[model samples]
Target: MRTIPLITVSLLALAVLAAAGCNRQPTPTTGGEAKAPPAAATEAPRLDEHSYAEPDKVKTKDIALELNVDFDKKELSGSATYTLDWLDPKWGKLVLDTRDISIDKVVGERADGNWRDLTYVLAPTPDKILGTKLTIAAPERNKRIRITYHTSPNASGLQWLTPEMTEGKKTPFMFSQSQQIHARSWVPLQDTTMVRFTYTAHVTSPKDVMVLMSADNDPKAVRDGDYSFTMPQAIPSYLLAIAAGDLVFKPTGPRSGVWAEPAMAPKAANEFSDTEKMMETAEKLYGPYRWGRYDILVLPPSFPYGGMENPRLTFATPTAITGDKSLVSLIAHELSHSWSGNLVTFARARDAWLNEGFTTYVEMRIVEDLYGKERADMEKIVARNELKKEFTDANRDLQPLAVKEGVLKDPDDNLTGTVYTKGAWFAEFLENRFGREAFDAFLRGYFDHFAFQSITTEQFADYAKANLLDKYPGKVTQAEFDAWLHEPGIPATAPQVTSARFDAVDAVRKAYLDAGTLPTAATTSKWTTYEYVHFIEGLPEVMKPEQLAQIDGVFHFTGTPNGEIAQRWYPLAVRSGYTQANPAIAEFLTRIGRRKLIMPTYSALVKTPQGLQMAEQVFAKAKPGYHPITSGSVAQVIADAKSGKTQ
Candidate 1:
């Protein structure tokens, strides 16, 4: 989900233009007079306006972190030493973003190898979105500042799970989801996507547990609970991730592997057996896989998102481990982010479409290459349906893909299919307008030029105009582009995707609805998860119990191992008042903490009085296992229902 808030700033707008490799030349006079450039044309120092950090004043270049993981206290105590570069010596102080964290001390390293304590303050002006601004004052002579701090129990970024919360029920697990602005809650740094820094970490954890970060991770090495990691490639703070648990690794390929609980390791490895091929396919489309090895850590069921594209290692949810390869498209999607997001990112939360949209488009391409055009089309069709639903139901105040004005109260609200589905359709629109071969070249060049930098939507629009649209003159008009990017809803020119597989599924759905034809195993024995989802989602919202039973008897969806299908089926059963499915619904809700699955099921249940009571009971039992990110939203769902508000 899109986490954090939107704080529009002039610095953030202009910085991304340069970061995206847009070269602005001084305009020459009409009469051949070479006049001096306008004063306003002078570039502003790149700062993440959305972030509480004043990076333009004092920037972070690299970080050296020494930390100990205290599982007992559910805290990470660490000293984060930042190698900084001062842009203005007179600024007097460096500001960073901090959430629920305790600052022990702040010290600066002098040129003569002397360390002195620096006066730092957690600002009295605390913000719900930006967190607290940590201001440190010290002499400009010291280019290095180290902050000793520890995460508080209230740190929303870190989820501490008990042994009983895990699959094996033998060891506890802790993982940090630091996207957008949550990084500050764990470690004091520039918690914006705008700042890029290389980092080396020395981590101490329990001897029985293994730790991994978004860096060069060694699966086979755990030296007496002390582990060291390095990420040479500079990355945005949002991608800085860490996880520790009793984990084991199983190699899927020479350069690809799976990390999960010992019991889940082999299953996850086999499930993502195509990881190496996905990397190879993505590289062929974009460029070489820059991060030496591409691996995946199958996180616990509670990992909110389907997958987080954390540089070398992608943190994935175990939900994707369906025995069939149908769900590996999520892996493909994350792999594509290696080029679109990990290598390059959005300058601010406002332009999140640049990261997600591009990745979604690339994911479709990779899926098409490996699977088939039909499979890719089916994915797009599902996404398009989701986008239409979101567009119709979205709060009108919220901006669309390319938000132009107004600050987002919470960036996580922007985590709609608009960014993923509409964004992909927009890319598809561009590809259709400017031939596939040309678009391919443009994408490869775009990534190569802006590698490891944060860019804005404006920069991307300008780059497209110069590289693609300019060549084709009036083929695509600027107004059309504006409508696609800056408008508040789906554009009329959006690509329309269709799938024959879904067509067949829809026909079957109609047959069931019209003539009460119960589909047997033979009818859908060859169907993929996508087709199953389409068929299940197409079922009538209010179905007779006997009809639901007949369908459930044939499909056994309640007992299905596929999370995707089960997520849809259980919600429908609840809305239809199929009490027999309640036990399975409760089990599903308690076991899976993915927001995508949890929210819909609970939301559907809360629509009726009885269902709302059921939802509350299940949530009470399940809340402890969910990450804050999921539980926070689920709590609101119940609260809204109690107040007679629509979801």
Candidate 2:
């Protein structure tokens, strides 16, 4: 998953959560504040708290899936046939995770290839976050089990968009965002990241639409109702994705391309044209691009996250196609995940830094290589500032890069800047301390050693100690290294990153703020999205109406096509009472469902009486088009404001 820059969605939530008084206890500090020793060289990992499946007992090895997409009912009826590996013969049951789903029956394959009905039970969940547990009585001799089920109309992982919600407005669209344990809502299996399984899928959709999955995709396949897919490589359930729509494909390179609605096919193809170059850059940094064909599927505006790194085909938000390729960092971030996340995975959500931090570090390296050091540096600075703003007293316990075993109440809680930005800073600290060449070699070795494996933070720590820390003893002490991991905030020794471009932009902003001086075309015309965001964010929290009008008139920020600029300028417009931008804000909010860009605008709007009315009115009309995740998040913001939790 790639988090957007400028401002994070969680930070906007934190702003509202502040008034509620976050009375939670903070995690214990390790290195800087308290000189504590690190854990023993290699400690055994605990079972995933977020998963009900006992992988040590019996794990899934592969799956054969058959499903029918019903647009009218807005449900997916499917049977997932699993090939199991009984790790311990004594274990007589196979447990899986599920949420808001209907199970017709489960059967086991006998020696003669005949299926025998198996006794199964659905256990109620104590914590809804983990979902329901499905346990099947499996005999030691049984190797194959099939589950016939249908997803709920309101499955959390799925977004069934009506025809009017799509770009073409002629055919309905359906897509899946299963990251962070949402897979259980659509497919019953071990939803934890601890286990991996290969899968083959047979899906039937509308004859007018096409289907795509994370598995191998035939770009030139016919747009028939039936589609078949095979994922030869083993992947966790979270990586299993599906989409069907009035889609068309255009190749950007021999191995790279995009799929989008006909109206967006050519534009999106042009926007992400550098995807092949990104793949080459990532391969040079790490190992080969293990996933066969690197393609991207650009979903409609209602897609939640910026991008999801689903093995072969990446699922992208329409917001990424800015016509200028200014937001391709999201692409780089997702592409690098082909190495850090898709190849080597995190065993649990608490150790998410292992996947995200490494990917952020590599993504920046790719950005620096493809764009320039200046662009990458500017991104780092913006991310750092956003992380600082996000870290509040209410969320102090959640600030550490390495979360405690039971700290995560919901998987979405892990989607904070701490895991993404703080983790990246830790990687950069290592790179700055040890030479880049040495660090690069260490990372290359790390990816190669752990390919196709799900590991815990302890495992990565052990590997790093043996390869990097122990190899260069005095360069980084064990205690200091522990600080970066166990500590609640950025370490004191973190490298101070600078960007000359941002400094120049700051000068222009300073003049404008101090003396109301208009920026000249020479400086303003060269500004990129990051530079514009920096300038807008640096403005005073409260400005005069005339000043707001002056900036909007000068820069045409009211309805800028650039999503990044709109996210920043809209909030400033709300805070400064720039009424001229209200219509544009409504259109932007209803059209773009990306949580990061829209949540902050809602957060700003909910603070005032008039703005709150506008927010509620707009959200009432827009909620139907949003994914469950996005709608739920924005609903909380509105509810919090109504209850005075946002005061």
Candidate 3:
């Protein structure tokens, strides 16, 4: 396990102190006289300690970006000019985060509005995760600073693809995924969630390609190799996203649409036909959608995460185009983030549960409202089972939802089933205890109060106590809240989730287990993807290869096009030594790059010597198509196996 360096900790402490001092309220003057304070004195709450930026000294209010996209060099070369709002000019310097970026020059505006070259220093590398700190000398009354820089070949946030990797095999593609601290690799800024700034950009791309961003986007207009954008809403740096490729768009509704490669745009539009309804449902539940239009861009199969909740436009995976709308729950999940994550963000990755868990709860509600209660209940039951399996693995490194204070070194480690599943369970518990109407009102009010702000777990608790618990004293107790939020593992009061459809599937699984016989196809002819997943997951862990063959012959799980079903079944086939499923497993591993499917299948393959060799061979061919985040995770699994460590 890795830890933060001592020097980084010291710098972070200084930044926290500076922020606290800057935020202190002004004192009353003597003889009943009062002095007006600077506008920056009433600073937004600084709750994030994961960043090295001292925003109290000098803060950025807006950003102006000018960049050129060179696919041949696989680089984004540009200059970022930031409008600064200073609090304490005597600090004399500004620090920003950078990784794998080449700086050409740093210049600042003087008090008399003249640009002057400024001396800057890139601090020594601290750790692979934290990157380096770029410090620039500042003039006494400087209001703007510009850094001319370009990204390196190994920038983690970027993924440059050849024509062969794209759906339309005629043009190349380039996309960015910059969440959870990867934004520093491509852009130098105060890369922290505590800071929010509006931005405008001028992007110059190839004549044949179209560019899109997380800002106001126009799909029908064609530009002469140059484009401009504006995002009026102040957003965190992680939501900064850009993509360029041979793309086309089709409107799904008045205020919603879908974008994809020209070859897949129509199919994607049809698959996501209900996106407008989802937005409307979410707004009715919470509040109005603050972002102007809600649209989705379906990337190629190599996208690592299920969905990234970029403010106006979401970056999605092609796996969600399952034709049957069974997988649109993922879209609902991302749309829920418009309220939970995009509007009100968690201060740091350590408090990710506040973003993910609340979104999960909201996702289920929206699904139930549009679809049905049975579908929603089935999803929750599956999630609960997955959480139990994670607990049974008993890995101390993978901590529970409410992890201990200061024990976390890397925020990515908190992205676990505990945070997502058990966190949703906590919300569900509250809803069940206090009644749906009351819980809904409370959530709407919570989002209203903290809109466009970064928050912490402790602050959330305080607000909940004052708003809900204090008003109705006998509904729930403080100890119960503490146990749910601070204690490890699921509390004893976890809400019970049940689904009749899953219960029927479980009975079929039990019948097969007890009698050692395969069921007829007629028994499951009317099942949906969720029912099939439940049936597959309920299979015995150590079934004989012959039994697996019998099951496959009847259900044809190996050739299923649905990524979720194949992901669950392939790992089971690998563990059972079913040689017949090898080709399908190889194709699945190589073609799809989602971490949820890739990690489990590869981890299962590396358990034996023969399986380890197969895993390596498949990975060699698939490595080029995978995003950096996916490849990094798969490499670690192989390394652990080589070191005789169980994954």
Candidate 4:
């Protein structure tokens, strides 16, 4: 998963960009941006802090599963059969991580081709967040064990949707979000990124629904109730995904397609038409597309996250289908994951930058190749601003590119701007320091060297010392590399990314702020979402109702069809007490569940007394439809407001 940080501003407090120089004519700078003194650096956590399964003792090598999807009960009753590789010859038990799952029985495959019952224990959960430990007595000679179980109605990983929650409101839908250790809620496994396994699944759903997985898929396949899929390459447990719905498919290219509800299939196919070109560009930059076929499943509005790169099939939010191709960069981001995240994996959650940062860097390269350098620079500028805010406002301990041991209580904590934006900034720093050609060559070699493997930050550092830093003489020192990895806040020596188009946008914003001049369509008509976000971010924190009304009159932001622009503009409306955007905000909250877009708006709303009341009113109706991942976050925002814990 890739994280896009939320930029929430306070109505009563001054905005950072505006307070810096609202009236000063803005100019793009071309050097490293300075920041506050950095906190002491810490070593990367050696252990996967979020998992209880010790893969070093006995690891899961392969899995075969048979599951039955029960929409009425909102549960999945299945049997997971695992083929294990006992690294410890004397190991007596196979312990797996599970959450809210009722175990029916455990059976072991005997050497005589017969199955015998095995005694098992569901140990008391050490941490409620980590769930229970399923320990089974496995004979040293036996290599296979099967557990028949059913998921809880409140399983954190699975979301069962009623027909009404979908675009084509005729059939029920179901999907899984397993990232950050939630996979245990549905399937018992060694739920750690350090463990990789090949899997084959036989899943049965309602006759009217279609099923797809993170495996080779046929867009033209018939919608039968039973579906069997196989993923030949070994992958971490989080990449395990399944979606069943009333969906239709449309081919975007010879090897790429789109899966969406009938009403959305065409729009999604059109929006992501450039996906094949992006894949080709990435292949040229790195290596071949190892996933065989690249397809996108444009999930319903309730799908949480911007996109989940689930191997061959990427689960994406419908928000990306913005009619225009402006949002295709998200497609590029997910496609790049085939090389960075899926092919070469991160061993632990703290080393998530290995997955997300590399993917983000590759995503930018693809965008620059497919689109233009200016567009890529605009994105880099957006990320740079987000990272700058993280330095000033985020927790110091969580500000490092590599999080320390035991600092993370939940795996989701790894999805911070420090891991995504700051990590990408470091990559940008390297490319700038050692010429782009050298850095590109290094990346290509790095991926090829570690293909189909999971590695830690320490391993990456050792590899980089040998291959990149050693190869490029005096470009960067070990101290600088370590500081970039472990230190809090970006180093003052980091490269600064500037965008010329954004400088022009800032000049327009300064003119509006200084002379009360209204922006004309002639100067703003061709602006993309990046310009809109920058202009909105530079606006005065507090504005008169008429001032906001005048801007809304020109931009019609409240009713804009673009979700990215709506996310940036809604908070401004809330802070300025512009009641006209209230209906649209409520509609957006109810219609979409992407946390990156909604969290900031909700945070902004809770700061004001009136906005808090409205937020509560809208959330009361919208909360039930949201995925567990998203609802948990928004619920915390609302709870913080009620407890006067707004930060």
Candidate 5:
């Protein structure tokens, strides 16, 4: 996730020094180094990361209280007050994790208290004394303690995050990514799993603009004009979110809606129509509609992850719009979080796959319901292919979902295909094994039992082992989970091919035969002597004659293309090869070229680099009302390459 370029992962060896110890306590830093950047000033406000856990909650059943965020055109108005439960009888120096954040007002129960600010590259060290530690003879279990302060916004090492643009200006999207404990970057609180607190956030923006947060609005979930909203949800500081933008809401899916502004709303809503069905399906499968109504708001181009599942409202990247919403599975991915993540949460980042992958596996239900199984498979395979491109044998720096919290070197990149794609694969594998009915029953049982609670990979594995072992006894074992999770590799189990209908070689060869003859599944399903003849005839002129000989009988090409293959192959014949290398390779190299004819191949070429590149080149040149046909992979490739590595 760091921009610093290195030839190989060798640089990661040095990276260990930056994050050596996860439990190192916070120590105050000299305030003179640099001032904390303001929170996303104009965009939605975010939740403080370290504020979620309540060490006192272990003994005192008091829930943590409201976070006050004011983004008025004044100073960065950031303040938090921890109102403890009145029942628990205990008191200690109040713990809050403040990163680049600064304190402006700290008013303990009686303004008689001491607080410390801590600083370390990896952890915050408490040092700044807040007033003096004077125990206000208030209830140790239930009492109000406010820590108010103003701080600027920061990239926080997550790059290109921004709110949707208004006119010529772009607002800053306010949200937090607490994956590896970056929550301390904003607020001060014990950033640990040992604490669980109820959160209510007050986000103030403009009088006309709407404010959305992690939870559906409490009784306070309602809006008071355009500028303010009170969201009541039992959110860990990490899941806290606020996105403020000029969003145009499209009310299509019965309480379920998709948001967009002038330029994006109409299309976004139209594209996200399936969201309604997904919302409905999720409710039926996952127990109740917890996030209230579902709303997906598209952020500006720079929005960090594909989607941020901030409880009720999801923050998604506009870059995925694809004009037609052709790639909106991200919408479903986020929605499933309502159950997998927002409900059955993860205790730490190490087992994050539970949150992300669970959402992915269930996401198929959402997509398949609306988009049909075939299209879902088509899109998923395309995504998987993109994931494959990022790995170089998939073993370097690999860690399981059991990884410690806030410790992964590159947190942003950690949500790789490994978790997203492979995790989805694991889910799919389970579904295929158990059959949809049993899988759904198991998932529902899991969510209903664990809803509103945190779950670990180990816990889930235990659950799976107990339940799945009856039929799949010993198959879904700790060993199976360790191999799939704790260890670095893809799950070795393969899905049973019911019919054994498809052949990769046959598919590739028939594609060649059907080059001029538009291929049908039947023609491309068999690899025989005749198919070889079709391939030779369809082979590109640039292909070397010898290369043709190497794969002469193989019928399919590998990454290691022989000189003969490369030379004789025309870029068009195989460049955007996914479905058209005669038997294409999912590629995005060439979006539709300057010539619109290439546009016809847009859908077919979507999963390849060449197709995406071509689309980008073509889009760079606008011929009026013409939307660029670039694929998601091209955009990502450009980002990864610019960031200095392929993955």
Candidate 6:
């Protein structure tokens, strides 16, 4: 995480993402014959479409860049030029998206290296880069291409690096996150998730600067005593990163190292001791850690997200050191990504569950092995409740996990417990059905097969179907994956307790309640969940609502009421006896918020103006010891409601 001071990206950022045109390059083939595609067919092509086709391997892509970074000011100033091969051969327009930026320079040319005759320069505006009627002509499918450009740091994540693990004068510290800021403003590429690439980023920083790409660092060379490093892997354009800062290194665990600010390297080594364990567990489970050395450098606050898994060197949030290794699961999660998310890129952002879920899945298993199952389970319960609350409160219904890659409205939406928890459950389901032997085998196999490759949700599903269900007896089906991945709903389940010998499920419920473990009350089968609010709201709708209420009430008859169940059952206890379930509701209301009636999903709960006002007042007035999620959700509700309010 290179700490970049937010300043102006002085000129040179002339990437007109708003508009771009396709220019083609001809390449020699097996027959040694070479030709360029027709100009009409290779006209302006969509950035994403140019990369994705019905195939497994990617062809070589040539991109040239020119950036001018101010050594004294820590500012990046430059513009970019590009030439792309057209697969579709559609003479449309070239467009790029930039945020909080302006195009300061322009240069476009076709493969022939001529300015106006071969290619055309487009318009770079506040929104897009458009050229009047520029058309690209090329062959139908495969063709060699070249794009050249010049730009400077005008965005959030652009960074300059040195070898000393520290910030400095020439390359103070810089890294770019194009998600919130614009990546295209600094470098030139096919800036969409739709197009995954194996790129060779020939970054020309200061002669004394050391640049780190999101691939394995091959070796460092000095041109006229200036530092340069070549990256050794193919990664997505989004995953493409550059860390230019004063860096210091601590080596460990066979090629694993930590690159930190020169001032922070020693402290980072002492603090990141857990990384050794994280790596061992991660390596044991996933395939061999690919990135030659794993290094983490701290970055500024605006460099959002827990960490950016840039191959071996991960960019981390400085806040990760809560002074405890307890939170280091983030380390494991990111490291685990060496295989799951990084190696096999997600088809789209909506299928983000694949990234997060696989990370979380490996994280739990790693933590359980490193720490214990009890701690893992405790974390699971906490995550479950948090996720449950978010899904319940938010207006946006859950989208299928296998969604096309893109951002959800609230970036937070993707990390919802629905994705993490249920997504973990999806992994757990695989492990339970296939056994760890087969499960790990499949994970390793999948990664090995698709390393540095792109895949679709269907392709991953196809892999699962071919490897698991097709081989196992009564294994999980594509239908199950479809239902969970495509459809959004709380997993429909409840405390199922039905058997040939049992007369009533109440006895089983009692047994389950008495014992902390789920009762083996029924024959082995699937499970369902009980959303307490809906059941309480439509009391008469259940198979036996009153009995269900009474049965729930018994759990709250007497207890400390501090645990998750007591917090809920106490309210049901109050409701059961008086109406259907009396004691539980009363206790919760009286002890929690007597005036605040339980509402449908806490999200909708505070939508009313009055509700939000009351909530804000209560939140501010409430004791500080209360749960953070409870307080945060209430605050979010109040804020959304007030912002949505006319006044």
Candidates in order have lDDT scores of 0.82, 0.86, 0.82, 0.82, 0.50, 0.49
Q: Encode model 4's per-residue lDDT on 1-647: one tens digit a residue.
A: 00111222222111221122111112111121212212332223324667767677688989998999999999999899999898888666676788888888778888888987665555433357888766665654368989889998888898888999999889988999999799999999999999999999999998999999998787778888999999999999999998988988999999999999999999999999998999899988898988889999999888888899999999999988777788888999999899998999988888899998988989999999988999999988887776666565447777777788777767786645777777778888899989999898899999999999999888889998998899888999989999989988888878876888999999998887788788789999999988998888888877988888888888888878788888888888888888878899999988888888898899999997888898889888997788998888888888898899996
lDDT of 5 by residue, 505-617 (tens): 34565555455233445655543222233244344534444444344334444321221222223343443332234322212112111111222233323335655565445
Candidate 4: deviation at residue 564, Å?
Answer: 1.3
Worst 10 residues of 3 by lDDT: 1-10
Give Cα distance to truth, residue 496, candidate 4, Å: 1.6
Question: Clashing residue pairs in candidate 3, if any?
Answer: none
Best candidate according to lDDT: 2
Model 2: weakest 10-residue lDDT segment is 19-28
lDDT for 345 (candidate 4): 90
Error of 4 at 169 (Å): 0.8
Task: Give every collision pair in model 4.
Answer: none
lDDT of 3 by residue, 1-647 (tens): 00111121224333332333222222222222323334476544433455667776677789899999899999999999999888785666677888888888778787788887655556444457767666665634468999889998678888888899998888889888989888888899998887889999999999898899999998675946799999999999899999889988899999899989988999899989999999999999899999998889999888898999998899999998888899999999999999998999987777788889999999999999999999999999888888777775455444455565565676666746767887888899889888999999999999999999988887888998998889778888998888888767788988887888888888888887898667787889888999999999898776799988888888899978888898889889989999899999999899998888778889899998888989999999998999888888899888889999965
Alpha-carbon lDDT of model 5: 0.50
Whole-model alpha-carbon lDDT for candidate 2 = 0.86
Q: Candidate 1: where are CA atoms >4 Å away?
A: 1-49, 397-399
On residues 218-314, what C-alpha lDDT tens digit does candidate 6 reach at each position? 4333333133343556566567666655555666445566666555566566667777787888788776777677767655332435677777678
Residue 450's lDDT in candidate 6:
79
Deviation from native of the Cα of residue 397 in model 2, angstroms: 1.6
- Per-residue lDDT, model 6, residue 227, is 31
Clashing pairs in 2: none
Q: Which scores better on TM-score, 2 or 5? A: 2
